[model samples]
Target chain A: MYEFFHDPIYFLTMIGTVVFALSGAMAAARKELDIFGFIIVGLAPAVGGGTVRDLLLNAEKVFWIEDLNFLYVVIVVAVIAFFQVHRLEGKRYTLLMWADAFGLALFTIMGTQIAMTYDIHPVMVVVMGMITGTFGGMVRDIICNEVPFLLQKEIYALAAIVGSCAYLFFLHLGLDEQGAMVISVAATFIVRGLAIVFGWSLPPYKAGGSPT
Target chain B: MYEFFHDPIYFLTMIGTVVFALSGAMAAARKELDIFGFIIVGLAPAVGGGTVRDLLLNAEKVFWIEDLNFLYVVIVVAVIAFFQVHRLEGKRYTLLMWADAFGLALFTIMGTQIAMTYDIHPVMVVVMGMITGTFGGMVRDIICNEVPFLLQKEIYALAAIVGSCAYLFFLHLGLDEQGAMVISVAATFIVRGLAIVFGWSLPPYKAGGSPT
Candidate 1:
C-alpha cells in the first residue's frame, strides 16, 4: 500500500480522475443541474471509463471500490468545481476541452497497460485502451443530453488507438514500460491537443442523401 | 447449460433483452443514425444494466460476455429494427415507451435478485436494482443527445425502486423467488405504464429562483 502511493502512474491516474471530474462538473453547469446532478455527472467521467474497462476484463474488484481514494477525489473535486465553475464563464469550455484531452491521454496509457497484463489479443488490448479513454466522456455527454463529441467530432478514439499501438510497438522494440507509457501518452495528448486547437474533425457521413 | 435455459427467469431475461434492443434501435432511428450506430446504440440498453450490476457485484463474468446469445440477440434485433422502425412511424413513440417500461421492470427484478445472492444490505440491493433498470435508458438517452428522460421526467427510476422493494418484501414474507419476481415485475410495469399513459411526472426542482 505504501509503495502504491509512490508509483508515478498512480499520480497521473489521480490527475486524470480530477480533470475528468472537473470536466463532468462543467458539463453539469451547462445543463443547469442541481448540486446532486453535478456530483453524479462529475463522477461519471472520473470513474466511468475505468469501471467499464475493469468490467470487460473481469477484474477481481473495481479500482474505486477497492480504494476509496479515487471516489473521494472525484467527490471533492466535483463539489469544489460546482462552486468555482461559474467563475470560469468564458474560459470554461476551453478548460474543459483541455482537461478532457489530458484525461483521455492518461487513461489511454493506463488502460492499454492494464490490458496488456491480461494476455488478450493485441487488438483487444488496443480496443480496451480506447474504451477506457473514451467511454467516460461519452457517458458524460449522454447524461448531459449532447451528441458525444467522441463519435461525431475530431479523431478522439483514433488518438487513443494510436497511443495504444505506439505503446505496443515501443514495448516490442524492448523499450521500458514506463518510457513507452510516457511516449504513448505524449502521442495521444499531442494528437488530441492539435485537433482541439485546429478545429480538426472527421467529415460527416453524407451517404444515402442524409438520414431521416 | 440445458438446465440454465430451462429456467423460467432466463426466459424473461431473453424477453427483456429483445425489448431493450428494440428500444435502443428505436431511439437510434429517431436520431437517424446509420446501421452501425443502430447496433451500437441498441446494444447499450440491451446489456448495459446487467453489465453494470455484475461489475458492482464482482461477478466472475459479465452476463452478456458469459453468454454470447445476449450479444447476438441484440445485434440481430437492432438490425431488424433498423429496417422495421420506419414502418411504425405513427406508433413508434408509443411502442418505445412500452418497450422501455418492460425492460425496466425485467431488469429491476433481475438486478435485485442477483444483489440478494450477494448478502448485501437491502438498501444496496434496491439501489443496485434501480441502477440496473435505469442506467441503460439513461445511456440510451444520453447517446441520443436527450437529457435523460429518467432524470428529468416521470417516475422511471422510482418504479424500479418500488419493484425492487416489493420483491424484497415478498421474499421476507417467505414467498418463493419465482413468485416474488412475477409480482414485482407487475408492480413496476403497472407503475411505469400508468405514468406513461397518464403523463405523470415528478415536479421539477425550483429552488433559489431557478438554476443558472
Candidate 2:
C-alpha cells in the first residue's frame, strides 16, 4: 500500500493528474462550456480514474478526498485555460490530439503502477491501465457531445495496452519500480505519438463484404 | 442467486430496462442525436447499471451479453422514438421526469436485492442501489452535454437513498422479499415523483457561501 505523503510515487501521480486536468479543460474549452462546467469536466478527467480505482479496490477514501491539491490543480488549470484559449491560435485539432496523447500515456503508466501496488492480477492491471488512460477522455468527449475516440478503430487504447504490457515485462525482468514507470510511459508516448504523426491506424474490421 | 430465465423478478427487470431505454431514446431525440447515437444512448441507460454491477461482482458475463432480448428492446424503443419524434409532441420535461423516476425506482430496488443476495453490507448495498439507479441518468446527462443532476443539490439521488433505507427497514421487519421490493420501489417512485411535481429539493450546502 502506497502512503500519500511519503511516497515518491505521489509526485509522479500529481504530474499525471495535472496533465489530465489540462487536457480536460482544453476539451471543455473547445465545447464552449461555462467556467463552472469547465472546472467540473476538468476535474472529472483529472480524478475520475483514481476514484474508480479506489472504489473497485474498496479503498477507505477516494484519492481526491484525501488530497485537496488535486482539486486545486484542476480548478487552476481550468481557470488558466479559460483565459489562454484566445491566445492559443494554433489548430485546435492538432493541439487536442497532442494533449490527449500525452494525458493517455501519463495516466496509463500511473494506473499500472497503482494496480501493481494493490497486487491485482497482471491482466487486470493492463485493463485498469487502459481504463485509467481512456475513461477520462471518454467522459470528456461524451460530456462535450462527441463520439468517444476509444469506440473508433484507433490505436489509442491499444497503445496504452502495449505500454502496460511493457511495464509487466519489465517487472518480470526484476526492473525497479521507477525504471519500469519511465520505460512504460516512454513506450506509450512514443507509440501514440508516432501513430498520430504518421497517420497510422489499426486496419478497420470489414463487415458484411462479398466473399472473396 | 437469481436464475436468468423463468423468474418474475427477471421479467420485471426486463420491463424496467425497456422503460429506461425509452427514456434515453426520448432524451436523445430531444438532443437531435443521429439514429445510431440515439440507439447507443438508449442502450446505455437500459444496461449500464447491470453491466457495472456485473463487473463489480465479477459475474460470469454482463446481463445484456447473456441476453440479447435487452438489446432488442433498446433498439426497438430507439427506432420508435426516432421515427415518431415529430408526432410525439408534448411536455417533454414532464414525460422525461416521469420516465426517469420510474427507471430510478425500479433499478434501485433490483440493485438492492442483488447486493443483498451477495451478502454485501447494508450501507454498501444502499450505495450500490444509488449507483444503479442514478448512474444511467448521469451518463445520459453527460452524453447530452448537460451537468449531471446527481452533482447538483437535487432530489434525484436522495430518492434512491431513501428507498434503499426503506428496503432495509422492511427486511428487518420480516417482510417477504417481494413485499420489500414493492415497498422500496414505491417509496422511491413516490418521493421522486413528488419532488419533480413540486420542485422539492435539498438545501444547497453552504460552505463559505458556495455549495461545495
Candidate 3:
C-alpha cells in the first residue's frame, strides 16, 4: 500500500498547500475580508496553479477534484492561519515570501514530472513547470488587487525556469525522478532565496511612452 | 454530418474568441509589447474562461485543445487587430465594452448548457456559466495591470449571473436547449449593454477610513 506521506509529491504538495494557504489567509486578514473571503483566498493559492496546469495538459481531472484531501487541507489551513495571522503581522511579508518560494519550488517539480509523464515537447514541459510554480501567487495577487508580483520586475518566474530546466537536465543525465526532483527543488530555493536576500531583480520594462 | 458551423456553439465561440482576442491584442499594443507579448495577451482572453471552466468540470481537455481553429482565430485576430487598433483608439473603450458584452452573453449561455449536461447541482451550473462569461476579461485585465473589471465596482459578473439564471429558468419552463439559449443570450447582452450605456456601477468597497 502506498501511504500518502511516503509519496514525495504528495508530501511536498501538502506542505506547499499549508504554507501557501497560510499566506493567502494572511493576505485576506490584512484586507479585512470576512471568513468566507479568507477561505477563498486560501483556496486560490493552494490549488489554482495545479488547476491551470491540468487544463493545459488536457488532464481528465484537476488534482483537487481527484483528491478531496487537498481541499480539506486548504480549508483547515485557512481556518487555523486566519486566527493567528494578526499576531504575526509584523513579520508576515518576509515569511510569506519564503513560504511562497518553497511552494513555487515544490509545485514546479511536481508539475514538470507530471507533464513529462505524457510525451510532449520538452520546451512545453519546462513551461508547464514554470506556469505551475508562478500562477498560484499571480492568482492570489490579482484577487487581492495588488500588482501581480510575477509580472513586475521580479526574478520569481526566472527562478522557476531555472529549476524546471535543471529538472529536465538531470533527467537527461539519467538521474531518476526522486534524485532529479531533489536537486531541482534545491536549485530553485537557493536561487530564489539569494534573489530575495540580495535584492536581485530583473530590469523593469518601460514602454517607450504612454499610450497615444 | 456535424459540420462546424452547424453548431451554434462553434459559431458564437469563434466570434467570442475573435473579439476577445482583438481586445487583448489592442491592450498589449497600447502597452507597446512586442509581437510575442501581443500574442500572449490575445490568447489569454480568447480562451482563459473556458479553460478555467473545463478545469473545474474536470473535462478531458479544454475546448481549445479539442479544436485548433480557436488557436488560429486568436493569432489571426491578434495580428489584424494590432495593426488597426490605433485608428480606433478614440472609441476603443466603448467598442471593447460592446464586444465584451456580446462575448459574455454568448459564452454564458453555452457554458451554462454544458455545465447542465454534466448533471452537477443547478446552482453550480449557473455559477459555472457566470465563471465562463467573465473570467476571460478578468484574466485580460489582470495581465494588463489594471484591477480586474469583475472585481471592480462593475456590473460585469452580475450580468453573467442574470443570464445564467435566465438560462436555468427557461430550461425549467420546458424550453429546449436551442430556445433557452437564444433567450438567455439576448438577456445577458441587453443587461450588460444597458449597464455600460447607463454607467451602472456598484458602490466601491471602502476599506474603512480610506487606507488608514
Top-DockQ structure, candidate number: 1
> Sorted by lDDT, highest first, which candidate order results?
1, 3, 2
Measured with C-alpha atoms, the lDDT of residue A105 in candidate 3 is 89
> What TM-score should be assigned to candidate 1?
0.61
Model 2 pairs in collision? none
lDDT of 1: 0.82
Docking class of 1: incorrect
Error of 1 at B211 (Å): 5.0
* DockQ by candidate, in order: 0.16, 0.07, 0.14
lDDT of 1 by residue, A1-51 (tens): 222255787888999999998888877777666555666688888888888
Per-structure clash totals for the candidates:
1, 0, 0
Per-prediction TM-score:
0.61, 0.58, 0.61
TM-score of chain A of each: 0.93, 0.89, 0.92
- What 10-residue stretch in candidate 3 chain A is worst by lDDT? A203-212
* Models, CA RMSD each: 7.4, 8.9, 7.6
Task: Note the residue pairs that clash in candidate 3.
Answer: none
Candidate 2 lDDT, tens digit per residue, B1-212?
Answer: 45324578778788788788887887788788899988998987788776766555555567678678889888988898889766757776677678778889989888877767664557667766876787776777776777566655457777888998999999899998789888999999999999888888754422122222
- On the 0 to 100 scale, the lDDT of residue B114 in model 3 is 74
Q: Write the per-residue lDDT of candidate 3 for residues B73-125, one digit (tens) a residue.
A: 88788666655666676787888889989988988877887787686999999
